[model samples]
Target: AQSVTQLDSHVSVSEGTPVLLRCNYSSSYSPSLFWYVQHPNKGLQLLLKYTSAATLVKGINGFEAEFKKSETSFHLTKPSAHMSDAAEYFCVVIGFSGTYKYIFGTGTRLKVLA
Candidate 1:
């Protein structure tokens, strides 16, 4: 079975500080991992993805994550946080075989303190 666990349900950060959101995943085979962000009442946007290809993956809005197979983790990070970055983030994993269904973590809510 494939699953993902978000380490934090909520993270609070100042506008200019760095941001970190931790995630752990378990898979029976090579898994596709993704981070998605959703603004208030808005659609989910892809932050980054880790295929079998890249270890260090970068995405939009100055966000990035590193796929660590040994650690079984993919944690999202940003050099600097923005007020607009205040939103909800979900750690997702795609099933290894059969129907390609998504497994979403509970979600981490980012609160940007101005």
Candidate 2:
């Protein structure tokens, strides 16, 4: 089975500070990893993904994540947090179970404080 876990349910950060969203995944086979962001009442946006490419993947809005197969982790990070960055982030995984199935994490709500 494949699953994803968002380490923090909620994260509060002041504007201009660094941001970190932790995620860990478990899979029986090599999997495709992804990060998505969702604003209130808005559809999900693709942040980044890892699929046997460079371990360090960059995304929009100065966000990036490193895929570590050994650690079973894909943690998102940014040098500084912006007010607009406040949203719900999700970690997703697609296991090679002969079909396309997305395993979504519970989610991590990021609060950008002034």
| Candidate 2 per-residue C-alpha lDDT over 2-109 given as tens digits, one digit per residue, 9 for 90 to 100 | 999999999999999999999999988887999999999999999999998899999998999999999999999999999999999999999656878888999999
lDDT of 1: 0.96
Q: Could you tell me the TM-score of candidate 2?
A: 0.96
Off by over 4 Å in 1: none
lDDT tens per residue, model 1, 1-114: 999999999999999999999999999999899999999989999999898998999999999999999999999999999999999999999984567999999999999999
Model 2 stretches astray by more than 4 angstroms = 96-98
Distance from true location, Cα of 13 in model 1, Å: 0.6
Taken over the whole model, the C-alpha lDDT of each candidate is: 0.96, 0.95
